[model samples]
Target: MAVVKVDKKGRLVIPQEIRERLRIDETTPLIFEVDDGNTIRIRIIQRDDQAYTSDPLWKAIHNPVFIGKKVSKKELDEIENDQWSN
Candidate 1:
């Protein structure tokens, strides 16, 4: 158990030991919830590189959309071949 102080900006730093044990990094996403109007629960969402690659929803959320003109399959293949040859 660890006691943390909330600063004026409402930010509390998790202890180093806890962070190390949980493998929490800067990219980690945390979910905070108040339980029973008294207890606060912090849920850590941990995912590996493989998870992001395998999960379609994650890919959809992170992948950028094509907004410009649409190219045909032949055009795309030609572009790929040209890049590979160079």
Candidate 2:
């Protein structure tokens, strides 16, 4: 196990080896939970756009007044290709 110290701002730097092994990058979404008084659990949240689109609740909310709209494949592709600014 690797030992790490939390900075003053409460951020801990994950070791490079662990990050590489997990294939985690800056954009990866992680979920943290306090399992007990001294233990914490960290999880990676994997998202599938198709799953969200096929959810029954998502379909049920497709009313005229709702602001959410279906994203086209082209738009999604464009977004994926677009470069994000820091």
Task: Looking at model 2, report the run of 10 residues with the lowest lDDT sum.
Answer: 58-67
Q: Cα deviation of 8 in candidate 1 (Å)?
A: 1.4
Best by TM-score: 1
What tens-digit string does per-residue lDDT give for candidate 2 at 1-86?
89999999999888999999998889776778999999988887666565655767766785434438888999977877783531
Task: Name the best candidate (by lDDT).
Answer: 1
**Per-residue C-alpha lDDT of model 1 across residues 3-62, encoded as one tens digit per residue:** 999999999999999999999988897778899877999988656656546778878788
User: Which ranges of candidate 2 are over 4 A from the true structure?
Assistant: 49-86
Q: Determine which window of 10 residues in candidate 1 has minimal summed lDDT.
A: 45-54
